[model samples]
Target: MADPAADAVVRQMRDAIMDTDLKLLQAVNTRLELVARLRAYKRSQGMDFVDQAREDWMHRYLAASNRGPLSEEGLHEIYGRLLDLTKAETAEDDPAG
Candidate 1:
């Protein structure tokens, strides 16, 4: 049962998976930076940074845009968590936070 060829394939697949994970992290960081800039502008304009309608539209847009293997429910869960993470991250950056 020692298929050396299969083992090598699996090893390469894992490396690709790790690279994808790093790309995802980098994308999240980039999104976070954009969000921080938006927040700063909103603050300067005396506008609320949290936009419920925009968030709702984003969820709907992402659901419509997703072509998957990934279920709609899974996307929803991950997106919800990402939104929460964004808020938590921005909060930590606040001086009064």
Candidate 2:
């Protein structure tokens, strides 16, 4: 029962959201590549693969910067997943892993 013009507008909005999702994916991939480069450098220097202190620092940073309906805990949990994924990718790229 939707009007044709309204339907077209909805489709355009959906496409725009999809493009935004793609951009987010691209940004994540770019960050992962940077993590890989860091891993390579650390490996060459015989450094550890995991840095718990840095991860903790990120948790603190995100928690302090959170300013939304989402609780700081919620932000930490979501960002924790991202950090874990990044760590896993970096670990996989590490020569020691």
Best by lDDT: 1
Error of 1 at 84 (Å): 0.2
Model 1, runs deviating above 4 Å: 1-6
lDDT of each: 0.89, 0.85
Scanning candidate 1 in windows of ten residues, the lowest lDDT window is: 88-97
Q: Please give, for residues 7-35, the per-residue lDDT of candidate 2 as tens digits.
A: 98888988999999999899999999988
Candidate 1 matches the true fold with a TM-score of 0.90
Candidate 2 lDDT at 49 equals: 62
Q: For residues 5-35, what per-residue lDDT tens digits would candidate 1 score against the true structure?
A: 5698888988899999999999999989988
Error of 2 at 65 (Å): 2.3
Worst 10 residues of 2 by lDDT: 88-97
- Model 2 lDDT, residue 15, Cα: 91
